[model samples]
Target: MSVPVPKGFSELTNLRSLSGFPVHVDMDASNSWCSLQELEPLSQLRDLTLYGIEKVQDSRMAEKAMISSKRHLQYLKLNYSASGHTIGTCGAEAEQQQQQSVTEEILEKLCPPTCLESFILRGGYVGRRLPDWMCAPESADFKSLRYLMMENLPCCTQLPDGLCCLPSLEGLTIKDAPAIKRIGPQFQASSSVAARGSTASTSAPFPKLRNLQLIGLCEWEEWEWNDCEEHMDVETAIAMPCLERLQIKNCKLSCLPPGLASTKRHTLRELYLYELTNLTHVENIPSVVKLDVFDCPELKKLTALDSRLQKIRIVCCTKLEVLEGVPALDSLVLEDPTMDTLPEYLQAVNPRYLKLDCNKKLYESSSSPGSSEWDKISHIGKRDINCIEDSDTSSDGYSEED
Candidate 1:
């Protein structure tokens, strides 16, 4: 449906969340951007997921102006677009002077800034660094931010140290930051550096942060944990003691750092490793409750699991075949390349859930495609495998940020 008229949109003042914008990758003619533009009048709006990047390009000027002008918003999800690199004027040379002036004026006029709770810039060109004011609590900008997720920002090279030190930040997910060679002080300060970087040592700790996920960072060769010790005094670098969940994906590291061993184990519950080609072993994740490994071909075996581990999932590991230790598990998911049969010990657990998919090349003796696996799992009151795949893979053209 087309968007309601700009003035008429205010009639729906009670609106809180809007999702499922049309993001058809192929279709280009649909111009329902006005409907999205109409969303600005939603004064109580707290959550938004704009998934139609192809459509957003048509009315970016209007949308950016509305978002920059509107206040009281807590959550915002802008559609992904490589072209969304900059938020101001583009090719219109004639109207550029007037438009730029108005945009700056509006941004300034939007005083004191709203207490944004969660801001996710997904699948866009976030331009290698966050805006200087993004995480500044003293500036009262994002004073309420709790979760921040930026995905597929190919050009983003580094995150400001100030961004990491946000007082209210709880969960952070940075995906597909191919150019981001390092984080915080390991990377040089660009013009995006705010206040010469925080004096707070990396070891000084982030009292509130609970979850962190770093994925698809091709150039992220190393996480400079050692550098933190040199730059930050011993007293300040030991801070992020509350971290509970850590997931690293598609990185180049062959092994985790010595400092990370058991340091946060008292609070950490889950650990995930995905497609880290150089990673040959999984170690130091003590007290972890759940272990998930996917596409790590170099990993050949499962090490001793902590007493607290409830589940372990290994998927598509061609070279890795054996799993040891951990007598009981709540669940196990094995998606492998080749297997002649299920590991004999795997059946002993009687797990609440178990998934074996696309292992025909690995296991020639297991039940065929639609066999006892589905029957066993379905009778346990769990979702059917086909249904689960459909639910996850369907292009609903929308996503939600936490």
Candidate 2:
């Protein structure tokens, strides 16, 4: 249910927090039901959210809100109503261009205060480029911003390059953005850093960022980092110096970025990959202590030379062949009902504890003392294997047959 604000709601000038303030407009009427001008006097706001931003008639009206003037403001969220527009169904090209222009202008005028610590942009933003404040030179305006999330962007083709330069940013998430196809070197360093011809004095990109996630970017296929020798010296440039966790899901990327694996090899601790249909290999991440892989059918090799790696979990990765280079592995878990035999990697890597969720045929072979499957896992200190019976009424299409 939508609640209506009273006629003089802005009269309370002392309010410090506000959320989900809807912008209501009547296209046929001479006057809008609610206008952003109402917020001009509410200068004490410390946190705010504006919903239905797509209904704002023009950039001038948004400028009246004076969001940047609220020095006390620390959090902001701007949400666009879902537009239900996809690639070919957005009507004529001219109309699309007009819509994009209006959206871009409105966002530019709604820049947040410099003290803002967290910001979120949600729904179907159709702009080809992000707001100017989100780009380089202007991005320095957000020196206090600590976190940012952009979701359900239907048309933006690339991430903001300025994000890599944020001095205080710690977490970032970009989800359900289908139009982003590639992440170039610009995403790792600002263009100004490149203009100087050396990174000797330039601070590392993402200096404080610790957690990053990329999900549901189905069209993404490439990430170029180490290949950008013309932009910066790859050997000398440092990035993501404090990163601890990274997750990639439902993307088409064929491999992890070489620069990321090389630069973050000492700071990155956990890696997670899921439903990456085109990914073929994961290798050389020497700092990851935990690795989880699921539903990546095309993955063929996973090699981490890190002595710190202690745990691994793999599920339904049908084509995986080699798993090597973890000398201190403590536990391994494998779950795949379709697999008829133990993976060949088990013969090369010896984990202290092994857990298997397999079908009846595999359990039968492994239970026999003299069988090859039994010989392979007999060296492990502890083992737990669950065999499921083939059946139509089971929860996973198989019932436990203990």
Q: Write the per-residue lDDT of candidate 2 for residues 1-402, one digit (tens) a residue.
A: 345454476787999999999776554434535567678889999999988888785898899889999999999998887853333344578877877888889899999988999999997777888987887767766789999999888888998888886779999999988889999888887434732233445567777889999999989999987734345554335677788899999999989987766633477889999999999999877689899999999999997657789899998898999999988999998888788888888888888888887787887787777899877787777777777554321322222222
In the range 263-330, model 1's lDDT, one tens digit per residue, is 43367788899888877777656678798888787886666656557888887666664555665566
Q: 136, model 1: CA deviation in Å?
A: 6.4
Clashing residue pairs in candidate 2 are none
By summed lDDT, the worst window of 10 consecutive residues in model 2 runs over 392-401
Q: Compared to the true structure, candidate 1 yields what TM-score? A: 0.60
lDDT of 1: 0.56
* Per-model TM-score versus the true fold: 0.60, 0.89
Q: Can you give the lDDT of residue 318 in candidate 2? A: 88
